[model samples]
Target chain A: MITFLFYLPFILGFVVIGVWGERKIASFIQDRYGPMEVGPKGLLQTIADLLKMLQKEDIRPKAADKPLFLMAPLLIFVAIFAGFAVLPISPAISGADIETGVFFLLAVVSLDVVGVLMAGWGSNNKYSLYGAMRSVAQIVSYEIPLGITVLCMVVIGSTLDLNELSSLQGIFTSETTYLFGIKSLGIDVTQIGGILSWNIVQVPFSFLIFLIFFIAGLAEANRAPFDLPESESELIGGYHTEYAGFRWGIFMLSEYAMMLLVSFLASILFFGGWNTPFPNIGSVTMATWTSGTPGELSGAIWGAFWLIFKTTIFVFVQMWVRWTYPRLRVDQLMSLSWKYLTPAALILLLLCGVWKMLMV
Target chain B: MDQMAVYLFYFFGLLAIAGALGILITRNLMHAAFLLIAVFLSVAAIFVLGGAEFVAVSQIMVYVGGILILLIFGIMLTNRISSDKIDTGFGNVLLGILVGCAFLVWVGDYILTQFNDQKAALEQTNNQTEKLGISLIADHVLAFELIAILLLIALIGAAYIAKKDKEEVME
Candidate 1:
């Protein structure tokens, strides 16, 4: 119950601002003014939209499967929100610090596909079915590269615990590198905690893995460029064609929530999650910016701050990518995942393993 | 907590059984697919209750993620054969139900005979996944390697079949 209470406000606030940010950024990219009416700089526009969605009539198709149709959005919401249970915002402020946190997160998130399929099939619409079919294929295909790329990180860290993975990338602390026991690479080149200590920088070809993961994450979340599942140009609302009012709102909310989940995982896996980018300077205190002191309220605050900050950056990048790239054809999307990304990720996984064995 | 565990186990057990029944009764193939998810989720919960977090997660990932999606795809491709309903003759349905029930009773009798109430204590380990990983490479290496080899062959076979169909289309 406490977890639900905490997540309610967090997700609400994130979706509200994330929607606004996406629009504002989209308009900025096109050199047009975005929503400027509702609140200052159109900040309250999402709230107004939310109210409008709530008040609208909940319409159902006459031929649609009512139970599955109604339950799809709720199931998707539950599955996506359950992922938050294992994601550690701060050392002190996590939901559930399970041993299989990473695997559990992947498992819960994958359940969203079932909801998408349900929505697609229950609508009794051809467009909805096509959307659902595409979504399942896209999501299932991308999950391989996504899981293997995550395995790359797991192999490097030797742990599935998200918190442990995060702590392993502590700023400025160099991972011990053993060069065949002949002589240790004595110099601590990556001693400074920051981007340098991050797995993206620390491991060989990890930057490449990070990029593949990001691309796969975008496809998995059904974002634009891989948004064939909901390609508005082709299929009127994709799997959610028949949904209306609050149900549609829930779908959109879950989409953004999925975006946030992917970004959060990316930050945790590659970037120094909850760890400040600023390195410690002599006699200068920037302690508050880094990971918070565990068990301290101050620590949770900073931990939340850094984690959210890094996540927002990634979300912004996702929005940027969304507007920038044209949506891939369905064949192209499948080929990208299977032909390129899978093999690339496989090689990267092997490279990381070798790097760990030989260098560290 | 122990009582809660017992109740939770019963809850999931009933859910699993209910899901299986739903699958058996549902005429709609898609509905059965969805019901199968409930069975998978309940089984995963049972695994979690048994202190096998890794197994529980892998259960969700593999069964829910890979297998269910493939099953749905299979159903979709066979839509022309039967889209709305999968009708069976009444006599056949009754026969199928009777056979299913007989099998269930046999399984129950076996469980009753073989089950042990004196279970081993839960291991005090923070990271069961680490132990699992080590064992997979150590004691279970052959089985693991064989599974990998099987999957590789299956992948190759699938690719070859798909490619042949594409070539036929082109010709």
Candidate 2:
């Protein structure tokens, strides 16, 4: 509950930063000033937008389904927020700490499809319906590869618990960690504890798996080149076209929050959540200094620092990809998921299974 | 914790029943679909209250996420005979009620007979997912494999049918 409360404000703050950051990044990539007026570097632009949104009249179409129209935004926000309850911030600080944390997170987050459907159908608008349908279809299709990649990690780790998964990739692991799961090589990366211990490094194939995961995560978060659902040129705001004021703000907030969630998951699964990238190179002892022992206050602080740091990097990459690439057509999007990523992910899953067997 | 579980059970159970009733009573097809999601969710909650977290999550993922979305998509794409509501014309009312009553009675009797045994088994179970996995692989491997093959066949058949339909449209 405490973690949940903490995340609520964190998400809100992240949205304020994320919106401004996205605009600035987009501008910089295009060689233009982003937001310069509001609060030095336009930091207060999102805040100003929020205040303006709050005061705007909540408009509803006369033909709209009143109950569903009113409930859709709340449902979308709540469903997305519920996913954070299972995500561990650090070794010492986590939300639910459930054994089925990863599975539960995936399940809860997918409920937003229902909310999106509600928003589209209840609005009784053609564009909103088209947006909702396209969004739901994209998410559902992308989830196949996304789930397969995550399953690849789960196969290698032999655990679904995110905290356990995180611990296994760092100095805190209780089991012996062989470099690339090859014992005959006679190299153990565990004690060295840095990039060597991270999942992508320990299991070399996981880098490919992580790439697939990253692409799938981008699609799942509705970021371009997969943001066809909200293609402003055609759909004009898509599912939230009928939505106005704070309701529309809620949709934007959830989109940014989803981006952050995916970044956190990517870092946690591949880059080693809350674990320092610096190795303890003999007398240097940088890894130990950076990532304090689990359960200590210093541990929590360092853990949060590294996790947030890694997450921010991934978030920036997501923004970079969004601005760099053009939006994919609907057919192109579906083909990428079903034809390309799905096959690649399935092969990775098989390879991961074999790798797990070899490690055993 | 035990008391809380009991309260949660009652809360979700009532919610499930209410949602089911709403689905039956609702005039709009979309409303009925949404009500069905509520029922599915509450039933998943009941699964959680029973200490079956894995099952609960799977229930939500497969039913609410996969199946319900497809169901809603179908509802949205279909041309409605009416403007707002999909008219549900009733037929064979007496036979429908009789069959429903008989099934309810049979299920109620079965649950009554097995309740105590199931409760005892549930209490003894811990780390249900691990145990479930072991049993599925070691004890019921044949059944699991058979189900997987069945689903694969069904998927292929559906794909073939869809492809044929598209080819027909193209011609």
Candidate 3:
């Protein structure tokens, strides 16, 4: 419940900063100033937008399915928000301490497809239906590779608990950690304790897995390059085309929250989540100073700092890719998932199994 | 805590039944499909209450996420059924009620007879996923392998049928 409260405000605040940041970044990319009038280089621009949105009358189309249409935004928000319940904010703080935290998060987030379908069908608009269908298809298709990539990490980590996964990749782990997870090399990086012990460094092939996970995550979040669902050039505003006022705001909020959720998962899975990146060298205790033992208040603070730091970097990359690339054609999107990503993820899964065997 | 668990169990059990009834009565196919999701979710909740977290998550993932989406897609793509109202013809109402009542009675009888035994067995278990995994690999390996092969064959058959239809369309 505490984590729930923290995430609600956290998501709202992140969306505010994210919207402003995206605009500023896009403007800079196009050689122009973005939103300089609002408070402090337009930091309060989203708040202004929110106030304007709140005052606008909520409109429902005559032909729309009234209950489903009204229910769609709330359902979408709830489904996405539920994914955060399993997110380990810090070692001491997690929403639900379920043994299958990773799987539960994946399962809960995928429920948003039902909400998307409701929005599309209930709107009684052709464009909205098209957008929703495309969105669901893309999400469902991409989830295969996403699930496979995550399964690869699970195989390597041998645990589905996010907190346990975090501990395994940090200095606190008691087990011997080999370079690239090959026991023959016998260079234990457990004591070194930094990026060296991270999954990407410990299991080099997982870098490729991370890339697959990132791409799948992007598609799942409905961000650009895979934003065919909301391609404004053709589909108008997509699934939420019939929505107005704060309902539209809910969709936008869910999108940003989904972005943060994916970024957090990626960092935790591959980047030694909440663990400091600086290794302890001779006469230097950067790792120890940066990260405390789990359950300590200092640990929670430092953990959140590093996790948010990595997540911010990923979020920036997502925005960068969004602005840089053109939206994928429908066929191109399907082919990328079924032909390329899924097959690659499968092979990577097999390789990860071998890596796990070697580690054992 | 145990009282809370009992209340949750009853709540989800009633929710599942209500959702199923909603699906039966709804004239709109889309609304029925959505109500089916409610049923699936409540059943998952019931699984959670039973201490089967792995099964509960899988229930949501497979039923709510995969199968229900496919069902919705089927409804959407079918021009005839996509209309606002579906007849869902009322045939053999008496027979349906008879079968339903008999099945309910049988299930109730079995539950009443075996409840204490099952409760005692369940109380001894923890980390259901690990136990499930070990049993799947060690005791039920053949059954697991057979199911996997069956699913793989079904997937290939589906792809083949879909591809054949695509080729016919092109021709």
Backbone clash pairs for candidate 1 read A171-A193, A172-A191, A172-A192, A172-A193
Which pairs of residues collide in candidate 3? none
**Candidate 2 deviant stretches above 4 angstroms:** B80-83, B164-171
lDDT of 1 at B171: 88
Candidate 2: tens digits of C-alpha lDDT, residues A1-360? 845677888888989998999999999999999999999999999899899999999999998888888889889888888888877777787668576888888998999989988998888888888899899999999999999999999888888888888888888788888777687798877777888888988888798999999999998888898988889999997888898898999999899889988998999899998888998888998889998877888998899899889999999999999999999988899889989999999999999998888774
Task: Specify the CAPRI tier of model 2.
Answer: medium
lDDT of 3 by residue, B97-141 (tens): 999999999999988986856675445256777788889999999
Mark the 10 consecutive residues where model 3 chain A has the least summed lDDT: A88-97
lDDT of each: 0.84, 0.87, 0.90
lDDT of 2 at B163: 72
Q: For each candidate, C-alpha RMSD in Å?
A: 2.6, 1.7, 1.6
Per-residue lDDT tens digits for candidate 1, residues B1-171, read: 389988999999999999999987777777888899999999999988888889999999999988998898788777762156544324587788799899999999988887655355444466688889999999999999999999999999989877856567898
Worst 10 residues of 2 chain B by lDDT: B80-89
Error of 1 at A294 (Å): 2.6
Per-prediction fnat: 0.78, 0.66, 0.69
Segments of candidate 3 deviating more than 4 angstroms: B80-83, B164-171
lDDT of 3 by residue, A67-157 (tens): 8899999999999999988777776775587878899999999999999999999998889999999999999999999999999999898
